[model samples]
Target: MVEATPELTSTSDSPALAVSVLQMLRTATSVQHKALEARLPLTHADLDRSLYTRIIEAYYGFHVPLQRHIDQFVSPQACDPKRYKVAALIKDLRALGLSDGQIDRLPLCCDLPRLQTQGHLLGIMYVIEGATLGGQVLRRIIADRLGIEADSGGEFLDVYGRDTGRRWKAFLKQLADFDQPEYNGDVVDAACATFASFERWLDRAGVLL
Candidate 1:
């Protein structure tokens, strides 16, 4: 775990913490972000259902355990458990023909980092919530290229639907409210670790090009 520096504890305001943490980790997170995007097999001229299924399966492998861990530490009022992506992933997986048994047996991601503080929890939520924003774009691409609709195998990507932006801003407000000084380092460290762990998990699942 990376140590929180004195500088990180400088803010108690939501907007300041939000700005500071993002500025601190922007470069690190961006690298991991671009790497994941580059590895997705969406550009092929002959993308198939099997390939798309594999992609969702890999996501399932990472998110199930990841979200479970996040939920454990996240405040009940911070995020609605009902809106988490794991359920959508399960529905989409089943829609793609994976049985309940098969879904249960899907390979789990290894070496996921643990959250030790509210800041750490929010950091991980930052990554997950941020993905929903990009998912809107990915959902459109999947629909155009793979013909999967929000009610079908693409539901996971269609998270928040028309309210994606609103949900994201709400999350930011929640994050801002977590402006305690003690958690500064944990927040930034967890966010960076999340991006790295996600990249590693995706690589392990063979989803990267």
Candidate 2:
């Protein structure tokens, strides 16, 4: 299981909450981030269909419960429910030729952290949404490596397609609007936990190439 550092009790006097949260997550989760980047199949130059399928399977395992909780806990006003990535994950898995039963049998990350509040939901959203920014780059790399496209096995990484930037900016604007000193610590803690959880999930799913 992934463990986050002890939570801070307060962040009332911190600098801009959104900026601080983002920076704190980047610094605190850097090790996990690098480990995943180094080991994920997409990072390798000699990627193959099997490796790509494994990567997608890992993603499916992590995203299923995460997205479920996000939809359950976060307000639609704060984030568009339609923008959730699980659908893309499922589409990609299907495109990879996994039968329903096979996909059902894929290992799931059952140790996902509880998301109990809007702040917690936002924090999780921060991690998943931020992934899309990197996904833009990964999409291109996967295309070059595996000859995949948005409508094919690349659905998850190619989530936003040409709308990635606009979608990200919109989410950022919404995040900025919801920024509150009282919830700052929760947001940061949630983001960090999300990263750690994802790292652990990937490790468990055997995505280390």
Candidate 3:
């Protein structure tokens, strides 16, 4: 087994450390993007949305009903694409080594309820802003690593990232103002767990140093 180095394990509340993680993810994404570009047989190819749509269906279809209760807090326009179902995304999630239970509760962590109204709105905002693009970047990373061409996979990243990104950032400003430290910590922790799983699988696949 490839062991994760201490550098990878280190964590702090320091913005530096958080920025480092984000930067590392960005580097990984760039590498994967280059890999896909090199392997794709064609340039200017649109990503296959049909396959992308299935990936959506797999993940969100099951979670949609559960998330409906949480949706009332967010604007209809804001939450619309957030509701897209992606089946391949969920399958790829398994390839990233998330446990079934962890994957199952994943939506709840994003669409938090049973908290205050601001908390609920914060959860939606946090997820829509912070989580969705991260999720797409990850899918792009996987598709690229697997040598899936633009004709087959690029649309998943392009469409999902571009569309959901605007709302995500809009909600992020809203999320930063919410004062519930405990809930904020929970949200951060969930993000950490998900990313750690991604890193772990990448390490296992020998894609990370």
Candidate 4:
């Protein structure tokens, strides 16, 4: 298990030893994270191409509107220009044999987590950016089991590829700025909400095995 080190950066309002925002967020959200991961269909023992396609299709339905929701709150500079996640999903879908029209016809997730404040936005982004990092492992698993690679049909799995670790560290660095005392609740709550929203969306999409 990769452990997060909590560095204290306290305001006058905060206790002297309060955990760093990233570590706090991680401890708060770990249960939801593991629960969601458990329910994902990616690791099914009987995994095959058709199941993989449906999984990617389900992801497209969720990721499209989810990224749009994030976009509604993100400043231009806040979003990494290289993080063309929706575009990567499109590429994977195309490589998996879906025409653009079929992709357009896929049902989208509507009930999303609320992004009401900077804390909320940060919380939601924490989940997303962390998932992008986790996808590096998933990418390799898909390649081994399904014979799919980034060039073929699994581009979204490791969207950042070799830069995944660097991108994740960059994201973690930005958390330092939001280490104020008051925003912790908002951040943690939004992360939990994001996970709940995603699980509900996945349930409706019927992609989990």
- Where does the lowest 10-residue lDDT sum fall in candidate 1? 1-10
For residues 1-209, what per-residue lDDT tens digits would candidate 3 score against the true structure?
Answer: 11222333334754433323323323333433344334332232443434333333333433444356445556667755644434434554454445567557553223223423555444333433444564565556547555653344343343345567676656555555554545554444433333443333333333232
For residues 161-195, could you state the per-residue lDDT of candidate 4 as single tens digits?
88889988887777778778788788888888988
* Best candidate according to TM-score: 4
- Which stretches of candidate 1 lie above 4 Å from their native place? 1-19, 43-46, 74-79, 180-182
lDDT of 2 by residue, 1-209 (tens): 12344334456686532344545555666666666677776868778889899989989898887777776676658657668788888888888899889988988788887688777777787778878888988989888888888777998997988888998888777677777768867777787788778878887877776
TM-score of 4: 0.89
The per-residue C-alpha lDDT of model 1 at residue 66 equals 85
Q: Taking the tens digit of each residue's C-alpha lDDT, what string does model 1 give over 1-209?
A: 12223334334564443335554545446666676667777555556789889989988999999877766666768758756888899999999999999999999887676688778887788888888877888788889988899888999888789889998888778776775556767877888788888878878888768
lDDT of each: 0.78, 0.77, 0.42, 0.82
- The global Cα lDDT (0 to 1) of model 1 is 0.78
Give me the runs in candidate 2 sitting further than 4 Å from their true place: 1-20, 75-79
Comparing 1 with 4 on TM-score, the higher-scoring candidate is: 4
C-alpha TM-scores of all predictions: 0.83, 0.83, 0.37, 0.89
